[model samples]
Target chain A: MSASLPSTSPFPFPRFYNFPPFFSRQPTLQTHHSQLRKWSTLILNYCRHHRIFKLSLIDALDTELLYNKSLDKRMGIGEVREVVEFMRKEGRAEWAGEGGKGVGGNEVWIWWRNPEEWASLFYEWVDDTAQKHTVLTLYELTESEATISQEFHGMDPDLLQKALSILVKRGKAQVFGQEDQQGVKFF
Target chain B: MSRKGVGLAAFDRSRITSAQYASHGNSLRSSHSTSVATQLSVFRSLLQQFAQTHAKDIRSNPSFRAEFARMCAAIGVDPLASSSGAGGKDGGGSFWAQMLGGSVNDFYFELAVRVVEVCGASREENGGLIGVKEVKDRIMSTRMEGSSEITDDDILRAVNTLKPLGSSYSTLTVGPKIYIRSVPKELNIDQSAVLEAAQVLGYVTVSMLMINLKWPRARAKTAIDDLVSESMLWVDMQCAEWEYWSPGFMLGTGDDG
Candidate 1:
């Protein structure tokens, strides 16, 4: 979904996105640090709108994704790897590998917003609905929900469910499975 | 006279003239002490004036800072303390080290550069060779207590280094207090460059440049020889003097031995 965003550049140098330094990790602290901050902001915004919770390092290297002539931007393997590593450090994503082995050459979640943040966002969405004690189906909580739409803005229903699971861990909500449907009982 | 009479006579002189003599001698002694004190006071005030005016150039350049530090240390004052007082701010070794090419103890060459850089601008103000005494006084002010034994030759070496590739200057001898024929100002270049280069090279000789030019060998030789005879290119080491002859130049002590 992000790759298909109309091939337009919002940054000052529409061609700068294609610059090698844009993708390569910088070593100098004074220069590289600000670059990292920009990258983090760009990725986080992209993730929130797309509801992109997971990003595969392999998939990011897909020629269609990074090297499409339409956007004219391509990231090397190392750059893709570095961006994902940066995301992981911010707790916005993690490896889905077996016993953390996936950290090396791992697939990552693009938690443009971390689960904790998403959980809080979910709480706000639930409160705005003014249905504080009501239980709602995961599908109902995400799709056609007025407050959820306002907050997540077309967030994937599945990723929304994952975000709610984080809230469940914090005793902010309870989840129950009945038949083939799951429901959230919010505090 | 007998011992008693001599004593009586001495007492009588004390009554009539001893007080006057004592007062006169005391006043002369006091004035003499005041003059010595005044010399020291004036010298110190002059140092403070110099340091205040030139400390920035002296401390900012690597070569100057090191040489200045060495000069301070040579006179037995701590470089750090003197620099801080002169700097009038929080001073650090890093500041000195950076200006002095990374370390304080690099060698006399580095110190020479620092000295040259620091003094280069001030050279004009001091009247070049004519102001050698000012330079000497500036250097001497840093001498340690109980060790005011710096020689005129040592001071001359410092001053001669300031004489450019072609220049002359005068210096006074300590013993006879005579103005010996010091490096005369006929070489035609500034002394600051010479001093700076000498400080770096430890010693340097001025000779005709070997580069091919329109001048004939004889003319160049005569020109260089004339300059040398006029005491223009003076080096502390007498051996470092030369004359250019066409393809090459001759280097040796020219029997001023």
Candidate 2:
């Protein structure tokens, strides 16, 4: 597959995806399996290009991937699990454990674009800044820096640290305590 | 807890066909009342109406209330009333309420909930009431894809099963919707042998709507595909992957059924 970012078709995109099965997961083994592959590829490709960090599975029910009106039929827990389990099998997703029993009620964290991508983002972000040698707290890495921009929006608080920690573990950046509870600075 | 069903006694799945005049021919022959003959006459007339109006589409058509009443009278109340209805203020409304209210068995409840939530193409110019033609059209449209092989008859049959469950054949209204009233509070099909086939079968192969009712997954993916091709669960096509959001799911399989 040529990964050079398929030709940037025209605006408003083609509305051809209105087919019913396009919304429903095929019940057949081969079809469902293929459906999963297509979904995962699309999800992963989008995240990689845009650098999306954490994705809540609940967020999957949007107009972007699924138009709300078309959902005339919603996904049941078992169906959602089948897809999530598929994602989990690959290192692409994890259960956030914030909701009720099973992964159905819980939020799923998609690592389709994992912390490694974030680490790369952090490096690029740091490289573009004039404050290369300057130290800043974790909070600043998230918000205060001009380089962070909108990319940090929705990144989980815990996950944000994990992403930063990856950078720390790699010796690309150093994190040390400064003043009190908020005393984290990346150098 | 007994998982409630009409059993083969209430209605046999394999027996009924489009040309069959009496759904309860054997039961009618057994009854020795003169009224039984009259009832058969009425049953024949209703069946004729059903065949004329729907042909094979009889399944989703409104339950023939007159025939159902006769069947109730024939089978006696203990069987029909006990499992099916709740003693209530209104006759039709109460039974309808019970059907819509809730069930103890996790299986059927799963199915009911899915039906309530399923949204298909907007067909009704007059609100959500999908015309029989529209419903058939949607199913037929999918067939051209060369993937799903389900026929309109299969969908109609599945919908017919919901007749007793409360689907307004004419206007798809809001209030007084039908729901499953009697599922076992603690019956475990996973532990039984007779129902083991249905129990182990994947949710897809079980009747389209029935698949939601504590049905098992299919033995293989091919079976599930066949179920879809048959249109047993077209309304549920999109979310074939997800399960319900139940507190019962919180517990493990070993928990009380």
Query: What is the two-chain DockQ of model 2?
Result: 0.06
Alpha carbon lDDT of each predicted model: 0.48, 0.43
Candidate 2 lDDT by residue in tens digits, B27-140: 566675677788866865564454345422222232442243345457453212333445553564443223323221122233233323331223111122232333443444
lDDT of 1 at B69: 52
The DockQ-derived docking category for candidate 1 is incorrect
Candidate 2, superposed: residue stretches over 4 Å from native = A1-17, A41-67, A98-105, A148-150, A178-187, B1-257
**Worst lDDT 10-window in candidate 1 chain A:** A11-20
i-RMS for every candidate (Å) is 29.9, 15.9
Residue-level lDDT of model 1, residues B149-179, one tens digit each, is 3333334443343344333334533222322
Off by over 4 Å in 1: A1-20, A25-34, A62-65, A68-73, A97-101, A145-148, A153-158, A178-180, B1-257
Tell me how many residue pairs clash in candidate 2.
34
